[model samples]
Target: MPQDRIKTIGRSRIQYGPLSDRVYLMQLAAGEAEAVITAMAELAQAEGYTKLFAKIPGKNAAVFEDAGFEIEAQIPDFYADGDKALFVSRFICKNRRRSCDAERIQKVLEAALKRAGAGIRHPLPSDWDLTFMTADRAEQMAALYSRVFDSYPFPIFDADYIRHSMDENFRYFGILQNATLIALASAERIESGVEMTDFATAPKHRRASLAAHLLAAMEADARQNGVKTAFTIARAVSYGINIMFARAGYTFGGTLVNNTNISGRVQSMNIWYKPLAPCPSNG
Candidate 1:
């Protein structure tokens, strides 16, 4: 098990969980943010981290901006109660930004959706099964993840991590083939929004549309739970998963440049999101 690297500076909770290279500002203290950010930077450098990122409230944005953090993406009224959130990042490694136009992401999502209208009406496999995972299934889930992924943002490969997360506002779903689990995904409640994350499938099960099926169930659960925004910070170079989000109706938000260290190296991630409730901008 990884050590608890969450630093409590004033009232803020800065975390360095399983994904070690990136320190997460899990809860930015509402007051004394400037001081907290300063402390965060110092600690991040001391830890030899490459990045410091946060999903922060819009009200405290200036503090992060003043600390040399850039806004990677934003969602209006993201917090189910009408608050906005910003995905901000500070690079302790090399100061870099990838070129990712909002319009370009829209174009890509549109093209992907055009190519696959079937995702809109996606249905589960006839013989396969979808069920919410329980704590007893943690070891089973971890073993399945090992077959598909080398690394993940969180510590899903560890049954203890899975069990702890499942207790902390995370809902997991799995697809069973002949009563054996072959695919898995999770929706983690963050503030008022939900991140459709931790998606994995065995190599033998690829191209079988299991992900889309599980995702459909995940989103429906989100809507029922009153989640307003759904998003994913997916691997940028992953054509199939990226397309899957677009096909499921998530629009492109922006790119997080070399932000995540996954599968043994630092990888750029694409932001894809969708609104479950109608937007005021649309009305």
Candidate 2:
């Protein structure tokens, strides 16, 4: 399946295509809510998309609610000014509103919640080298992502796309052994914080607690960079990722039902977030 295309409509960024079979209002600009809503609806109708997913400020929820959207999840203080980010959705296809894997999803959530605050930060293994990835390493990163995920919401398997994202606000990090990249993750800069995402570990390296170490390092780096918060939208049915976040002390915000197309299917996602200490002032 082709990757979704991200485009700008009325100052807001949207990702819509056959890959996810939905229109994702990824970012919304102030006061552009109505135009974005209308445009996304029109696009969804013309393309026969089954879902319209949006992440908007809580204050603007009323407008979207009036347009048939309902809040699926939310992260408080998601913005720098203390505004919450609401994950709202309107399912054009009735079946899309319900997850077929609801039982498994809930089980994962319960397991993760039981392990909350149990994550202990471990040092990077003696033989592993943890390094911040540059654009030159985009190919290696893309190769790792390709091996791990059959499909992703973003075009992470493309080397050029990885490079482009690095040039933007994304900072990729990798754990390597003997010069071979074994695990990878990235932190995307958002206003006053970063999104800790794109975590992938080589199959052979699983159960070694690599993700926990990476999460710790990412949090430290984000704090040093003046980031005030860190968050992730992980695959809801995945035990490892959800538990990892819970162990790392991230609070469970809620779930976005069938909101993301990942690993070759439309899957729901769980929101997790943590507040980070700000960088020290130079003065």
Candidate 3:
């Protein structure tokens, strides 16, 4: 992979950085706790990684915690049903630690929530349009992403990487002005829960509530498509997006400590969620 290191080990999909000290664990199924933990720690030491991060069902938190992983955050009822999700991290490389501005973020989040704008704004004029994107528009999407974010959590700003994710169950939506793509978001559905993320807006149009309009459109479409929930892991330090979610009526789920590498640094993230099923029609 031209991006991060991806490996499949015993029902787990692990993504790690060759030049970084962090690891992301996905699809972490049950069983083989000792083997996975031991092997991962040894590999982290050998490959110079400091921490391994995993977001899993809350029920599994205890098992991983017993294996040296510590709970960083929890989102209540995050699963499609009523199960919760917990973010955990294990330090394998000695003397290497990562800490976010948790105290500051708490204050910022609280203050931002007080000023949240609406989630769904009125539709734009005819000159502005919104459409669900495909792999062919990856270059445009990547360009906008690179412009908006100096560093992204994943290798999404790469066109080929976008196509790769498309093949692995990812979808994109774009906002266009005068037929030019301006803002974008994605909904990566896992079962009945959709991760409403990867949001970016062009610099000139940042104040126009394009994200809010786009989110409303996405949710309306998702409702028709059988989506049961929408959720996000928003950057904790960013007031704009955080407030946007709050305005949209998403419940605040807690903060993930130093969770993702974004905008050139490892930053903490906040979880926001809303149930999407069995609802009224969109305006």
Candidate 4:
């Protein structure tokens, strides 16, 4: 299957394609909100997409709202300039606005919150080691993501993309057993915060609490690097990931309706966030 395409429009970055049947305004550059808004609408119309999702600074949300966009989630003080981050959406196909799995999504959220902080700091298995990934491991990382998800919003199945991202504010973490990568995650730097995403574990490696372990390490790394916050847009129906984030002290923001395409289908996502204290610089 063909993956989504990412491109820049008037200094703004976007991802749009049939894989997700939506256009995502991934980054809205300064003074480019109007251009992005127009472009996203045209692209969605041209491609027959069902949704137009955007992550914009709170100050510019009124522009999008004036264009028929609605707020789905918000992150307070997400940017270095003290502006909140808003996840806004405009629905092209009205039917795509509702989720049939609302009950399950809620159940998962409740369960995760109910088990918050239970064994989240479990020790890594004796034979496994957690380490930061180098470029040489890009192929292995891509392969791991391919095995875990049939389709994803990002081109994680491509080694070159992984390498390029690693060079641009992306820190990947992996767990290895006997020197072979088995589980993986990444932290993407965005201004003063980092988005903890791209989590995947081999089928055989499930139920071992590896995601929580990776989150803890990612948080430590972020603090040491002066990052102030961490957040994730996790699949709402996924009990494991939601539980893991809640267990690690992340607050539940709000859910995005039919926002992402992952594992071969469109799914709503839940936002989770946590504040991190910046550690004294060792250097």
lDDT of 4 by residue, 18-133 (tens): 98889999889999898889999998888899999998899998899999999999889889988989999999999999899999998999999997767575678888999999
Provide the clashing-pair count of each candidate structure.
Answer: 0, 0, 0, 0
The lowest-lDDT stretch of 10 consecutive residues in candidate 4 is 115-124
- TM-score of candidate 2 to 2 decimals: 0.97
Global fold similarity of model 1 (TM-score): 0.86
RMSD in order of candidates:
4.5, 1.3, 3.0, 1.4
lDDT of 2 by residue, 133-167 (tens): 99888899999999999899999999999999988
Most accurate candidate by TM-score: 2
Summing lDDT over every window of 10 consecutive residues in candidate 2, give the lowest-scoring window. 119-128
lDDT of each residue in 14-98, candidate 3, tens digit only: 7877534577776666675556666677777787877888778877777788988987766666676678777788866544444
The regions of model 3 sitting more than 4 angstroms off are 18-20, 91-100, 115-118, 121-123, 279-283
Model 1 spans with C-alpha error above 4 angstroms: 1-4, 17-20, 95-122, 278-283
Candidate 1, pairs of clashing residues: none
Name the better of 2 and 3 by lDDT. Answer: 2
Q: Score candidate 2 by lDDT.
A: 0.92
lDDT of 1 by residue, 1-283 (tens): 3433656778777777445476778777567778777776777778677788887888888878988899988777777457787889988767435434445544655566565434644456688888999999899999998788766666678899899999888999999988788999999998778999889888888778788888888888888887888988887767678888877778777777777657665677788788886323434
